[model samples]
Target: MRISTFEYFTSGVSTMNNQQASLSNLYAEISSGKSLQTAADNPLGAAQAVALTAQAANLAQYSTNQSSALTSLQQEDSTLTSVTNVMQSIQSLVVNAGNGTLNDTDRSALATQLQGYRSTLMTLANTTDANGNYIFAGFQGGSKPFNDNASGVGATYAGGPGQRQVQISDTRTINVADPGSAIFQSVSSNESSPVSSGSAANTGSGTIGPVSVTNSNDPANSSTYTITFGTTTTGTPPTTSTVSSYSVTALDPATGTTTTVTPPTPYTAGDNITLGSQTVAISGTPASGDTFTVAPANTGNVSDTDIFTTLDSLVNALKQPADSTSSLATLQNALTTAGTKISNTYNNVLTTQTAVGGREQEVTATQTAMQTTSTQTASNLSDLVSVNLPAAISQYEMTQTSLQAAQQAFAQIQKMSLFNYLSS
Candidate 1:
């Protein structure tokens, strides 16, 4: 086969150029320590790396969200602890006010202390987070939740009903705050004793005691009983005697039923009158037409369970004179209600605190899991794109050697060309 000088030179040049290109690629892989520099190097690996990068970005955002959620929850938790302490102090004051020996002046001092506590509670209810958002304002985070009402008796809640939540993970969300209404306004009462009171219009010296439950499971415990006093005449005209008597009437609000409960029974001072599953004593002489009422403590009404109103009412009653039987009865009733409401509010606050702690725990766990996932994803991505240093270095050295040999051979071949041979 006869080969021309042009063909020989062209073939040699092409072979050397290809070897140099391979050597350059190996050098790039060695220097950069990356097996795949572009998509064309490994399309499947590059696509997988893109997905992993996006995942890492999402994970980073979730971590940020988790941090924010933890901060808000921690703030709420701390505020609720303060509230619980204040509530406990208020409860102690209420119990002290219940002492029969405490006169109006002593009671007034207790009331003053309660007012201070009320102020503290109001501040706690309007607590704000690091970002200046109200923690208990529900969805109205930017607005204050509780403020003193015009009457100066209780606080008004201007927040929404919906609790705010933060997304901690892709499928998980946690409540970061609780509404003021849930914590303060709409507390539940656990008092078993029915509330009893003499009618304000009663002209009698009659006083009634708190209801004592004899059968708690009885259905009658839910009914409101009214005791109406009357005078009955027994005997002939000249020897006629008037007997003080009372009749019971029951109203069941759930079924909207009102019924005359029992026939007239003669009244005896200091005797207990049975009303359904409960009994209350009339300790003083009751005039004819006087009435007293016994009602369930928990009426399942929001207005009935307001801690602020309960406290305000007790404070006002404490400042009043308990010189008369009726006044004393009113004071006793106020103490009972206040004690019950405050205790229930304390429990409610504790429940809210527990929930906040639980959410904090969940957020912490999610952060740990997210961290682990992020580490695993990063490892997978590294495995896909990272160069094997030892293997790449060995391949680079071999390619460099081959390129050097090709260069030397091309130099010798160029000198052996026919024009060069004639010159020789």
Candidate 2:
């Protein structure tokens, strides 16, 4: 079809304008190094990039959480290690105190050394993190977990029961620290042993020795028993004789029932007396009305599991003069109790330390997995939006050439007309 000059000229100009616009867009893409600067460029790719970017943000946050969790766990593990060392020293001292050769003065010096270790242990228990938060304070990170009690013997836990946790991944959460009560104030029931004591009010030289388990399955292991000393008199006044005897009264904790061993058993120094599942030896002549006790130390019993209190009591006992058989028995009992409690405390600390290590491993694993996913996410996001420099430069060069040719041809055509042809 025949076309007017005006229409042809307008069409030619429009084609050049379209070429310029395409060149400008390619330049922008190359300059910005992003192929999908706007959703209009590639709707699907832009949407995918958005999703990937959000995922990357979440991954970053999770990485931060993992770092924080690792820091806290590391701090706890280190502090617990120090605590275990202190406990080991204390255990050694307890064993040394039990040596028969050490005099009261030497024992007192050892007690002083134990006090130093206790102070060290207290410091370790109140350890703080990089942020100055108490590591063993459970959820009460801002509060100190343990402090000396009124008697300056043991410590009181001031923290909460629930441990602090951190989310390391989308589906995984980990404990950053253990509660002070769990670590320092509790012992496993299966690991606990009965504690024995002579009545503080006893007027006799009679003292109870360390308890030994005669039957592991006996229910009396968990029972409380009291040994009462009595006297039996017989014959005429001029030739009258008296024999010392003892009666066993047991209190069943589960049933809350009290049972007395039928008839009084004769009292003998250094003889083993069976009380339920356990046997305890009594040494030194017990006078009438003297009594001793054996009580179960169940799990979570602070009286038995508190390492600080055990140490404090042992220190006090060691400082006392063992001038009599009763005093010596008392000192030996303290040593036995302290040694057992220290061992239990050491085990508990190890268990807690293992848990912290596990958490650290979990966090490290999660971080590795997240790093892999993050790399993939970044690659996908980059592929969807990033410009390929070599390919973009090639296309840009071609477009520039095409646009220049179009403008040159338009200029040459504009010069062509009937009047110019006639003049030539």
Question: Per-residue lDDT tens digits of candidate 1, residues 304-380?
Answer: 66677777877788888878876776676567656766776788788878888999999999999999999999899
What is the clash count of model 2? 0
| lDDT (Cα atoms) of all candidates against the true structure | 0.83, 0.83
Model 1: how far residue 313 lies from native, Å? 0.9
**Error at 339, model 2, angstroms:** 2.1
TM-score of 2: 0.88
Q: Which candidate has the top score in TM-score?
A: 2
Question: Which regions in candidate 1 have their CA more than 4 angstroms from the true location?
Answer: 1-34, 189-257, 261-301, 389-394, 418-424
